[model samples]
Target: MTPAPRDRILDATLTCVARVGLGKTTLDDVAREAGLARATLYRYFPGKQPLISALVAREAARLGADLLEATAACRTLEDAVVELVTTAVASLEAHAALQYVLLVEPEVLLPYLAFRRADDFLREASALVAPALEAFLPSDRVARAAEWLVRVVQSYACSPTAEVDLNDPVSVRVLVTEFVLPGLVPSNMLGVTS
Candidate 1:
């Protein structure tokens, strides 16, 4: 089955972005990548900002769906959290366009990561991740925990740490045990004392 024109355009946009970076990827590039006319591309997206926005929305939805599915089989909250982090990290690492932006044109993300925009983006991310966490955390704690979890996953995926490599399951377990689980799970469950 073929994807709709908009989907095709967005996919082509990512291909172009991955190849040339977002700043250098013009509508002509995306149009050519999609094998569609420039007029057809404009018919779907009036401008570059709108096209970028649609692409971001599409990717976010895809990530959210993947996360929900990946964590669905976990038997415990700790397992769920571990799966969440590992899955999210894996997905982020697999995104070519995003990886390119982060590695080659990090400044492209600066505006979104700053002040008010940061909060909005975090809130949106929290909402996407919150559903996967609901089964593991209390209703009231879910949102806050999701926000924190998103922050942790994003931070680790973006900057990484020598102490914990999210790509490694064993290391992810250690991270969940010593850091993540301790926060989401009660101290008694973790056998910890102040």
Candidate 2:
């Protein structure tokens, strides 16, 4: 299905930002990319900040959906964590706009990720993982697990101190199984009764 005009404008904005970095991208550049007049762009976004905010919101929703879909079939907490981390790392690595912001204009995204709206991002991310975790965790624990998963994935994606390759599915699964799963899953679930 074809995306709506506003979505098209947001896509154009991302393209513009990716091409010229956020500080250098202008409304005129977005309008040209969207194939709309500058006046029409203003009619839709009103200003640059709103446009950038909308773009970030859209990307966040897309990432949430991607995470849920990637882990939909997970039957165990271990499987879910593996799916979540691998999918998140791969998705963040593949996102052109995100990579552009991180590489060329870290300041443009640092506020959203680390400061101003960081809590909002964490809440949204936790909610996204809640459904997948529900099968293996109680309601109270689900939020904590999801939050931890998001933090770990973000840390690994942003900065890796280890030699493990996040993009490698086998390596990610092994790392999660060996290190993360033992803490997240109950002993009973792993067939070890106390």
Clashes of 1: 0
- Cα shift from native, residue 65, model 2 (Å): 0.7
How much is the lDDT of residue 144 in candidate 2? Answer: 86
Q: Which ten residues in a row are the worst by lDDT in model 2?
A: 185-194
* Candidate No. with top TM-score: 1
Model 1 Cα lDDT, one tens digit per residue, 1-194: 98999999999999999998999999999999999999999999999999999999999999999989998888777787888888988898899999999989998897777687899989999998999888766678789889888888878866778988888888988887788777865676543211
- In candidate 1 the C-alpha lDDT for residue 66 amounts to 92
lDDT for predicted candidate 2 compared with the true structure: 0.79
In angstroms, how far off is 7's CA in candidate 2?
1.1
Model 2, position 114, has a per-residue lDDT of: 88
Task: Supply candidate 1's per-residue lDDT for 70.
Answer: 91
Candidate 1 local lDDT, residue 116: 71
After superposition of all CA atoms, the RMSD between model 2 and the true structure is 2.9
**Top-lDDT structure, candidate number:** 1
